[model samples]
Target chain A: MNKKWMSITVSLVLVFTLLATACSNKEKNSGGSTAKEGGKGEQVTITHYTIDSPDRTFVEKLIPDFEAKHPNIKVKVTKAPYEQFDSKLQSSIAAKNAPDVTSHWGYGGFMEYYNKEMLLDLTPYLDGFSGSDYNIPEDVMNIYKVDGKTYGIPLNSYVTVMLYNKDLFDKAGLSYPPTDYEDKSWTFDKMVEYAQKMTVDSKNLEEAQYGVDFGFGERDQRPQYFGAHVYSDDTWSNGGKPSEINLTKLEVVDAYKTIYGLIYDKKISPTPAFSQTVSGQYGDPFLSGKIGMSVVGSWSLAAAADFSFNVGVAAVPYNPNGDVRSVLYVDPLFVLKDSKHPKEAMEWIKYLITTEIQEKSIELSGGNPPVNQAAAEKYYNNFEGIEPKGIQQVFDGAYKYGFESYNHLISNYSQINELFINELAGVENGDKQVENVLPDIEKKLKDLLARVNK
Target chain B: MREAALKESANEVRRMRKWKLSQIIGFVILLLVTITMLSPVWFMVTTSLKTTKEMLVFPPTLIPKVFAWGNFSELFTNTDIKFGQQYRNSLIVSIFTVIGTIISSSFVAFGFARYQARSSSFLFMLVLSTLMLPYPAIMIPQFLLFMNLGLHDSLLPLILPSFFGSAYMIFLLKQFFSTLPDELYNAGRIDGCSEFRLYWNLTLPLAGPALATVAIFSFIWSWNDLLTPVLYLDSQENFTLPVGMAAMLSSKFRLAPWNLLMAASILSVLPIMLLFAVAQKRFVEGIVLTGIK
Candidate 1:
């Protein structure tokens, strides 16, 4: 009787425990106000996931001001590192619990949400704000459209150009920079000639100073200089149209040989090791007047404002064939489809893209050249610094040289440069020919394309 | 002749002593190898003290040129990347996770060690096999299940899954428990100590070293995890330190202030390292104690 009673008590206890668990679960499920049911009432809290940390004093300042404007709504911003953002966004989207707004990297990542039919067709709201109101260019606006609708607003548009140290040019007794932006009568040959003239060999000869430096690290931007014209065949993929990567057809190989010549044949450019060591020395090597010229972004103008040397800017040099191109990449701001308060989200996004907001963001970030040409020109007129002069030159030059799309999806952009660095090193150190390196690289390029697409 | 032979033996002893001295030199080199392995962590700590401008310089400095104490203050003051809330959430998750691991794995391991069934060994192997399946393979399916269950965007998803007992932890505890004498359980049974009493009073108390080992491992794993918290937690108020640190490091334009990142990184590491130092004695004891039984 005692053993039987013990078993019965144990069974009773187990049943009671399970009942308690069920009751607790029911309470939890019913307790919280989830935004999915079109959250109502005053103090409607919305969650945002972004790569911006609240840890920055700047981010904290915006929250209280935003809350004060909409007393009934409180916006909470949550951030994680960029590396984790994609996976987190993916998982959150799958769960239908994603933040109301997210800062997307724009191209391939945005496609994932679009293909899943998880993104809202933001076109209906676009009419409320015009290109005039948002200060977004129609040309840039076209990049964000997909399948006859829009899902994002262009945040910051950037163009890549060459920033040169004018002090180094004056010291070498070279002519002053050309004032006319379109006149690249300053051809690739003149660039090489000036770079070589500016290079100095001290008395010891053990150490040498160079006139020009190019990035040769894991960054695929190094190869974007070559690949932009080579593998960019989007029109062919989308339609049956024969959109060709012009480099494979054109005599662009001659331009490639010339860049190789600048480093090896003329020895004017810094050695591979020198460029690697000084890679993001944005204002250092060139500003310190060691390197005469560098191919860098438009932001370099702002970075070099306080430097001791005078700065000059020019468009990327032209190939003798007249096919000159510079890359324009943008980071886009977007609202999630499931947001309960799409109107408020749209208002914030519209505010973020406005000329006033763009200038504020640029000021906060120190130098984002405005995507809105008129506003950028306005900013220039108001600005006191000598830095905006070069930035203004960059804006004028971009009209002729800039290409809208970039090769952000080139599979293993970082790894391709490893091969380029090796081959470039081989040419500089030995009796290797530049002509011999292209075939192997061409094959490697095809393989990378296959891997990424596969 | 006797004198000369004795002198020659003394010389041989001296030669052996010199050989031992060389071995000590080899051991010193081995100690240096261990220190070299630890140098990356040392560099991370020191680099966190450096100003953003100095951190990026070539031939990275071993020490800070200007140590900024404000980096720590900035970590708390600057942004919504709430280091305090994150630290609290991680502590809550890790504490509950450690407790769950000890309770569930001990029960599962006891059954494995004490039972005698034809399928027991097969089932044990099946559990061990789960450790080999990479997390990505099951990630999507598991995510959908939780979403349907309405567990997403909360700490429940992060914490509740740990209650079922991980196969890896169960296997580890089973290995330690298997080494325990069968005689102890049998004696308890004869004395009319219930199975629950045997486990609670006799088995668990004696398994302290193994329990300590499991607790420490579970705590570290949950504390350092970035992926799960990234996937489940959506609110800034709920973010873990790893997620916060990652956000601060992602920008391409205005370079992330490295000093603040470094200071936050130092804070993230301190508690875990302290736990490791405290639990290390138990870890060593567990390995030795588990083998003895």
Candidate 2:
């Protein structure tokens, strides 16, 4: 009898505990859904997932305004760190709870999402607004197009340029690199000459004041100067042989040799060793006043504006033979196919690209160069003190000369990048010649391509 | 005899000197290792107090020239990041996890330890095999299950899982329960005490160290867990500290504010450190008791 009573008591307690847990969970669900259905006539909450950054602040600031303007819609922004955003976004999509709109880069993962039919075809919405209303150039819009259908609206575009410290140039008694894109004198050889002069303690290279910091490995930037494409054909045809490894080409070899000279022969740039120690310690060697010049993206403008010394912006130095080409990084906003409110999401995206929002972005965040032409012009022309002179060149270079390499589109980019770096590591450390390693690297890359393509 | 005594004294002095020398060497080595281990923590604290400009300087300053204590204040006061609310959420989740894991795990462990069904060993092995299944393999399935149950976005997804005893914890507690004498249980049964009372009284009272061990592990695991919280919780008000700190480090437009990040990191780690310090004795005893028995 005692045992039976004890068993009954235990079962009752367990039942109550489970009931309590379930009730609490149900309460939370009801609470959230009720708020969504509250006062302003059936509010629709649109979730926006983006990276947590100062740019997020702009979104947060604009949400209230957006909500006030569109009384029925409430924008909920969830931000994760940049590193975790991709994985989280993938998991969320898999879980069938992806945000209505998301910020994505114009390359690799975006292409994957588009291929998977996860992203909405934004073409129908594009028809609502005229081309002139968007103000983004045709070529810029082409970046977000897959199979001749647009999937994303580019929020901003950034291009790499030679950012030099004018104070360093003056101290070195050298003329500034030309800002004009067509300047014949602003070639790779001329930049190298200037780098040599600007570099201090060329003999004791380890402790030397560097003339230029590429901000990344030489393989990424130096190849661009020589117009060395990673693939024989630069077109991206899905699952087709549009990609064939072309690392063994004479032009590509020459590009590698020139980069090798910059690191080992000229000693104008910091060695990989010096970079390992001081790169993060002194943020952006150019901004830290440690290097005379740096090849950096438009994102560096905010840091440049805060530099203690005067800064100068110029077109990236090109090879005399190669056409002027700057690497452009475009960030685009995409609406998910599973989004409950695609029309509303598109409206928000259109609002983001407007001149008013772009201008506010400039005032609040020292915004990225607006994709809208009028806004870009206003941003550069009205830009005041500390914005490095010749800010217009960034826009000019991007519009006229910007080219995104096949590297960004390739799924095996990190692997290919690793192959190049591993082969060049010996040359970078001054132990091997570029000529000796090029053929070996080309063989390995071809094998990798065959395997990856298979 | 006097000469012998003097010689013995000299030998004793020599031995003492040698002993002192070895002791000094050991102390020096230990001190060096401790310093090396503690340097990163020291750097984090100092870096938190540094200005953005100072943080970027090469061969980083061990001491900040301008101590920006405002980093802490800024972290607390940031409107976008509800640090206080997230801290509270973490505490709630961790507390429930600890209680649920202890109660459920001990209950399951007592059954496995005392019961003698025909397939008991096979069943035990089956429970143990779950430990081999990695979290990722079952993550999606578990997520779908929770979603079907309408528990997807709530803290219940994190909390309710703990109520079903974990394989590792159950294995640990079962081992601990087996070490106890059966006489206690038999004696309680003779006194007309039921199986439930016997477990509630005789076993649970004697399982203090084991329960403490389980509690500490559960608390720390739940507290530090990033993936589960990130998966389940979407709202900022419900976010855990790890996820919030990760968000702090990855900025899309501007450079990450390292000082504020470090300050938040330090604050997040403080609770775990305090918990460990408080329950350290029982934790160690539990491990030793389980290991030998």
Candidate 3:
């Protein structure tokens, strides 16, 4: 009896354990299958990964509409946080589980994705897509092309413009910066002169208020205004060949000295150390009204709305070469190379860039200028409410004289930029002069470019 | 003698006073350290309750003037976030991970503790060596293996790995099991207890503290895991809390809604906090017992 009982107990335990494992496995399988299934046979589910944004409401509202129209298709939108999205996307692609469609910034090593063959050449999709039906401009669409093959569709674009605090300008008794794109009076020298006048300091040289701030770092805008082409040629745009660093050029060196002087010599902008003390306490020095003006992107409009005093916009301070240029950034949506449902992804991208969707997205996002020229014009004109004075400058700056930022075209951009920034940090901090460090910066850039290109 | 006794008492009073002063100083330092350590958490709670305008105000406020309980309500009511679904997913994954880790690690630890084999030491060392291998080093191979198993986008990838036993957990359990008196096992065998029965009824019941430690650790680890879920789970519906919260915090075009993000963060951390609170006594006892033995 004892033997029989023991054996029975052991057998029962084994049976139960196996049963449990089997049940769990079955549950997992069922859960996976249910998630995979759309509704019926031949229903395609396209998963799109995108950065989380306040404008995400538009996408969320539109997905159901898209699903209703295409009964046989389902769209799953996954948003990764902006900071982690790039690394997350890379890991997902490495795992061979990349989303069908993803949002990408059109600059800053975007070609690395194309070069690695991770992006689907959407030229064929664009051909089938009634191109003329959408009001998206050729220039905007061309931004996403690599070697004559289109890979992405421009979803939204923004221009960097001068955001000046009107209250601060009044306190300094200075006239408002020119809002017109063609205003030659709004030159780099004029901006510096205004900054010098506005900067206030105590006897101890403790700045009570800074003259001006570049919400982006000085490296981003100064090089552009001075026409210091980092690349040898326009290879970044045309995709012809790799180019060498042009930091040794007189124009580049002069731009660096002028910007560095603003921080260390002129003491018009807050240093990195001073900025750290007030971190998280204010949105930005410019918005906080501690600075007279800031060269910032159109996205700053959202923050501008909340300012206690009035805010105004102007075209970025111009170069001496009789050209007014500002940095333009285009956020695009691309179809992944390994997507099983490329056609569906293309359809979604097409839907995103339509004039109606673009206009609505701009309206919903509260100032992301549309890529479609007509939609952009419509958005600018129909915009309601207490507009930030000279808001038209954003559109004018974009359409007339916007150029890609320095790092936008280079494949090894991050590495090269890091080296430049580290060298420039010394200049900014008064530890080294621009003339003294330019040689080292030039050498490091060349070595990095060579290594990366090789 | 009476005079000497009085003098000693006076000295004792002086000594006690000095000791009391030192203790007060130590207490103040500890209080400061504690506040410093906990300030970030306090900021998170307060920020969650502050309006966007208040958040961007110069010189941040410690206590919000108008508490925005609406942020929490918005988190729950937002259809797009699916916070409740993510919370459930996290709970399910964490519970399974705890059960699996306890069961698998205890089983393996028992073998290492009880058995005497020719290569037992070598095999045990081999298990310990796996602790040196970083998760990222083997992440690709493991991902590929799961992909091949058709478990790419499911919580199975997160849960199933716990069943195989972790080297660290096994090491901890082995250390614990080895401290058990061997005569109990010998006596059980003489009375006709099988090895499996010994493990199931006798040994496991006595291993309450160790098992509790393993359970709590597993639960916390699985609950806080962001990367594994982000890699495996593609859809938001299947996302765990950490992944969901991360998604909510990320925005490229504009700054994240900090108030809402903080509210979601508070919600995500509450479960682990509650678990720790409930298990605090046992958890401490487990660690103390493990250390002593």
Candidate 4:
């Protein structure tokens, strides 16, 4: 009887709790879909969707300024986590409730939307707007044009660079890697030498301090640094068509051997397991100060905001064959054609690239170089240890010799990368040699690429 | 005779010692299990209190060099995270789900078990077949249905379905209801109780343990459900704890703030822990009474 009474009491309590919440739920439900337009001069809420990035929070800070400038527009922003961003964006667009403005991952995403006719041609929205004010070069803007229709505006430029822990280099008594992109003295071998000196290996991986992490430079982007072209440059210019792949090249094979030897033979770099073990609980190993030099994209510069070590950004080391190549990535701002307020979305995107916003991006986004060459020249001044001249050289070398990365411009890139990574996993795991694995993947890679491109 | 009595006394003492030894061994074994079970919980609590820098060091410090009490404090004050709002959202959704599941599942189970018909058994089997359908198979059509009704990006989609009864809960409950003797209802009928009154007054009160078991399961499922909210919710203000926490540590372009995530996680799980602690006895009885493996 006591148990029965207790059960009845619990059920009664749950009923009361439900009643209380139902009332509040009614209040929230009544205020649903706040995006409706009001009077001629009344508030119009425009939804902006963005992914988690160094720029995410920085953009959040600037949103208030944007809202302040346009009193009639209330900008409601939703930031998806990095992994969920694509799925969320696709779903939102499919539901015909696409955000007014969003950060397009790269050229490929913009082109994908273009082929689907999902993008709003911002060319009409630009009208008399001068691209120069925001450091948007006409040539760069023209790069996004398809038959005289412009769908995207350059958000920022992310160039691959070597981010070294200056404190670790000093402790190891090695001179810092040159920030001068033109320096002939810095090479892959020189980097490995410096790396070997700093590496302190232990049977217990958690205690080991790695000398370097190539940060996917050792993956598909391998050919980029080695001056080997696997795909035709015309792929993007031809509306993201299938590109014939040629990975049997001597340079391509050598690039794989070089990166893998660093992991297996030299053992100076962290293996895949090392990174996962450390990164699962801790953040990035480089930020943990366990890594000496991490050759990665410029976006990693955002680590300086919280990183304890003195960090510096330098140009990538040249290949032993006297070739130099830096991978360049450009994030674009795209508004959907289905957006309720296209004009308002344009205003918000334009605000993201202003001199003030771009400059603050360095502080907030950590390392996003404003496409404005002048701003890019002064990008490193925002950080404590990074010198202005050195950072300028990093940008200069990129513009001089670097090509736009093919991943963002090609169709079925993420899929191609995934398949490539799966094939390359054994090499990284010390099971297979690059010479053996690279040959086998060429057909599989081409097939996957063709399947998606078609 | 005195010597014989002494031998018997010695035998009794040895027997007592052997019993005491087994008890000691049992205690040690249980202690080992307890420590093993609590290890991850200990790690979470410690990690929450450590600074991000300290947490990242290799061969990670078992004891933090610096105890960052600020991690928990930051969860409340950070403008980016609306912890209070999300907590309220989770609580409301979970509680309502429990109430709805308990009432609806029991009602359906009663009808299936008590009222017999030519097709009643077949219908129960049909209901059980729904348990085999994977959620992803139905996710799209359901999403489309909810979206058309303008319930997308709202709590309604998360709470409304609970009122219809879950197939798994219904099945567990049907089996439980079948065990109740028919004579109870027959006896109540003889005492002038209506069919509804028998269901309401007699069966429901006796169905306490089974109902409690279902309520607990529904509450936990709703509380920890990330997919429902992640799919349905758009605004941060509408997010529940699971979705909000996932957003914070979502390893995308941004690095996860592990310390803050741990702190929020510890705080987020307290209610579930408390619920279990408060209702543990009845919950165990629920499982035992239902004879569910």
Candidate 5:
């Protein structure tokens, strides 16, 4: 071999060897024992996977505090986008490198993880932790439990309510919609008629303002609204077993028709084309005083608050026959079964749920509407400029009726969400009518359930 | 009337002659197309400067209402997402990956391109076939392998596999190697240069454009990759920019601060875009060297 060529070959191999050694060094040091104090001080690293990005100031703060409190136990955190969280989580589970703890979305998601045998049962630890005393509703906790075995803790809870423009109400010479706190006279039809009355089109049909603004393209919001209505109002059977979910009931169909009519008969919503031109403009349309009312959540309460206009809050309109009031959704945190440090992870979860952290986190996040009843009492009951009026009253009325994603009941929820979207898109297309659409959906949902059950 | 018509026709001819109108028109069209293609990137850069309220304004403003230098400031202020650390992680991973990919792929490509062995062809085909397998199917198995190897969460999970060379890169390099005269290699053998020596000196140096092509491809792929980092890295300190950016989006109940996200995104892509611009000549030459046409 030529001396020059031989030297170059030797140098390449040398570089390759150096790289390999460096990589090996990195692997060796990447993880170390994060041994707990009370347990064997043999290093025990608690790897927590959450959907929270490293960028969120809250998480940046939370991790340091967590690490500081448990200096002996190393807390490692990984984050992924919400869109890919479930898939990435499932992959982690299958790989058995599943994190010791994870933050997951609401009960529907919590239930899926529970069924998969992927979550660590927290029942043994709950005895030491007084979770029930925290004023998180009994029903909310029940959502995280399966067969009376708790699987996770609520990290944050969100609920949907009727958000109204108070300024628009005043202009129309009408009072804010009432909840049980004032009087119980408000009914579903009355709410609809009021929305219709409040709707003001300009001098031309082309310039007409919408009465109510609703999220149209996204079908996920539909379930949050309808699920509450179905649970409270419908009565039927899941085969031989008795069930309250009967969409076939006249009153139930009427409720569906009434909600559907807002789009078709009223033409109050932005057309699909216009809405698509500017997505998520429901907030803009409502806040700009172009729409009189909207059925939005406390998550959107801050949007109205940011507006230079007046706004009010009310319970989600109730059905007098069913008498259902508010609908609630909560996002929770769960411990994975394959967690390397389940005990330490549970302690972290416990710390997060404490009244102190929950209150402070909620206050920092601007009106998360605390799950803890006592912490909630600390907030002003009647703040004039907070956008949504009687925020606490809405919180009080919230627990009366709650619903979760129908997809959560079944394992293949993504497929069901796709089916729901396509079916609703058809309704939006005006090809398959809403009345015609439900039975096909009902059959598909039942078929999905049977396959899963089998 | 005939005089008037003749005057108008002469005026038209004069107008065409003075402007060289078609060429200028064509150049203008090309310029417009280029600007149109680049507008989205320009928008991303501009939006990074916008305040949160400005980003969500109705009829979306083309320019920032207020420049939020704070977004860039916040990126560095946090210990959780040390922007410098993420950039270093990405750089370290990409540099190592590029070197590994080049060495491994060239070695593998030499066997395919120069050797007459029967199994060489078979092995090359086998490598090509791996591209067809859906990634998610083997995702669990790959994760377990890394876990068993105790490489999970470290740069090894992201880096070590590149040492084996990628099928696509090998194919690219092999195509270029094949186009080179066989006599040059024969001449190397006559000089008593071993197979390794031939590859190390004459072949690789001559294939500089192709090597640069593979290196740039490997660097960009490694830099922008989110899924691998998300799957492997288990600490904030370990996160690359993409994984860190994703976490930022989901962290709060309120929508992610668009200003911060856009600023971070722009910063994340700047190095890569700048690299592409700097390497444009070599990249294009490398593409042509591969004889992709």
Candidate 6:
């Protein structure tokens, strides 16, 4: 080779080697984490993967206390932004390098973890362990059981409730919606009647006050409330393996049409387009105080903290003939199957649920209710800007009649939901008739289910 | 003679008037376009200074009703976020990335431009083919590879990849370098200068614009990158700017402090804007000279 060619090759190799060595040196210093002197029994550093939220913040704050209590086990909290958190966890699990402990919001996810057999069944832990921290409610405990095996514990929950503007109700001279779920007078039709009274005719979405904002496009949870099924129960039973879309069924169509009518015909609820105009950065129209009532989850309580008027919590309007089902969001924390230190991870999960910690969960998290009954009781009673009795009734109402939507229970739900969420938008926005679109939605949904089920 | 002179002066005056009028119109049109383009940046600046409550107000106020000076302070002082540390981390990674990418890509580009071998075309095609490998397809394998190297949680995974040379940058720099005369390299070799010296002393000084372009693009890409940092860095202390900024937004499930997010965004953008301002001349020249979009 020519001298120039030889010299060039040597320099390139040297440069790369120099950079790679520098990086390795840096990595060496960062990775050589010696046994934390304060810890006992050869300090074990366990990574805790959590999504960014009050829950993650709650975990981060407890890290020091956890480490101090269990000196042998070092707790390292890793919070990926919510968008990346699940994907990263899945990647780590696939790589067999999953974090020792992690959590997910079960209403939208975490079922996949169970379905894929990625979670460590916590039943064995519950059997061998004895502690007051594990005093979760019987119903909640039943939820954790997958084929009689305890899978996880719910750390926090977001129960669906009716967030009403008391000021609007009073201005219209209407009585507050009954907080007691048992009140037969407080029917679905009755709530709509009250809404019609308060809805002021306006020039546009900005000037006009919407009587209700039922979060139509966010997810049409209306079918569950109407005692209607969008799909057969067998589909949910089969974990969505042989699902059928019943969106064209009379009862299901009625449920969807009722909400659709509310936006276009009745003109009480805000249209998806209307809400877009009024929603600020948070996309919350209810917080603007222009709406009479909003049927949404309790997670919205944090956003309502700064409301200019009084807010009331009430049991969501229910179908008297149908089952009184409300969307109950249970966010659980579980140990990964691949966790190297399952015992240490279990220790961390248990410590987070002690009465002291659970009680502070509501206070620290701003608004997310703890699944622990005591802390949850405190959260429902005397919530920010809400009537204590009304909020309690609503909380009780959800617990008594709460059922997770089939979407939450099924595997491949994200994929299934993606298929029709956009196609169903035209019906949701009132531009297309429900009768005309249901057939197409069913076809597309079936296609997706067939593809995903295999 | 006197009449002709007067007529010439009048014509000159008319010509100047026409020229001045069009210039005024062009200036006005460009000013409007610039303002139209920068409105989002302006909104970010204004929103960063507004309270979260005020930011939500429709018909958003161009000027915040109340100046929230606290948003900037809160970005650093907020117990949960380590914006200051992240800012420093981003700088460290981006600077090293620029240095590594410029050196490696240029060296590789020089070989392709000036050197020849029987396998040269085949090897160049091989490098180019790597650009076709989608990130999603290879991300898992690359992540596993890094995990085995014990580099997963460190900033090394983020910076190490750039040193091996990137296909796009090498391609861009090669196009620019091939235009330079072979005589310069030959003369340097005739004087007994080694290949390293020729690259350093003779070729590099002339390739400043292309290198600056690569430097700018690499810095911006590294600075703005969210995926690598999110995948690699687990600890908050090592997070880059984009990851740190995203963490501030919270998520859809909860209330995001947009005011605080906007403030962090403005702060993060300062370095890039300053870079563009400083290297404005060369960056434009590099893109034009390299003929690479």
Residue B271: error of model 2 in Å? 0.5
Q: How far off is residue B226 in model 2, in Å? A: 2.1
Question: Predicted candidate 6: interface RMSD?
Answer: 4.2
The CA lDDT of each predicted structure is: 0.63, 0.74, 0.72, 0.75, 0.66, 0.76
Tens digits of per-residue lDDT for model 2, B202-243 = 888788888888988899899988878777766667788877
**Residues B1-293 of candidate 5: C-alpha lDDT, one tens digit per residue:** 99999999999899887677777888899999999998887778777888766665545678777778887988888765677788788887887789789989999998799888868778889999987887677777888898777677677788878988898899999999998898998899999998887887778888888887898899999998888887777665677877777666664345456667788888888778887888888889999989752
What is the per-residue lDDT of model 3 for residues A1-454, given as tens digits with 9 covering 90 to 100? 5467567657755754664455335423211112345547577777777665556545766788788877776777766655556666776677667778876532234566665577888888766664456766677667777778888777777777777878888988999887777777778778889998888743232346777776542363456666665456666654523566677778877777777678877888867655555444333555446678887776676555556468777777766763536677776787888788888788878878788878777777666777776686655654334353456665676567876554544565656666766877787667888888888877876777677666
> What does candidate 1 score on TM?
0.78
Model 4: colliding residue pairs: A82-B252, A108-A408
Order the numbered candidates by TM-score, best leading: 6, 4, 2, 3, 5, 1
Model 6, B228-268: lDDT tens per residue? 78887777777888988877665565667778889998899
Worst 10 residues of 6 chain A by lDDT: A27-36
lDDT of 4 by residue, A1-454 (tens): 6567668758876775675455335423211124555676556667777654335645767778888898777776776665566666666666666777776552235566676677888888887776787767676777567878878888788777788888889999998888787687887788889999999887676568889888743256667676665666577578766566667888788777777888888989887777777776434668768799987777677556567678888878877564545767777778877887777778877777778777777667656678765566557676566787787788778666665665656555666667787998898888998888887888898777666666
DockQ of every model listed? 0.37, 0.41, 0.36, 0.32, 0.37, 0.36
Extract clashing residue pairs from model 6.
Answer: none
Docking class of 3: acceptable
Ranking by lDDT: 6, 4, 2, 3, 5, 1
Alpha-carbon shift of residue B266 in model 5 (angstroms): 2.0
Fraction of true contacts retained by every candidate, in order, equals 0.37, 0.39, 0.36, 0.21, 0.45, 0.35
Model 4 ranges off by over 4 Å: A1-44, A52-61, A105-108, A111-117, A230-234, A248-250, A320-324, A361-368, A373-379, B1-33, B251-255, B288-293
Show where candidate 3 strays beyond 4 Å: A1-43, A67-73, A91-96, A105-108, A128-133, A197-208, A215-222, A237-241, A248-250, A280-289, A306-309, A321-324, A381-389, A406-408, A412-447, B288-293
CAPRI tier of model 5:
acceptable
Enumerate residue pairs that collide in model 2: none
Candidate number with greatest TM-score: 6
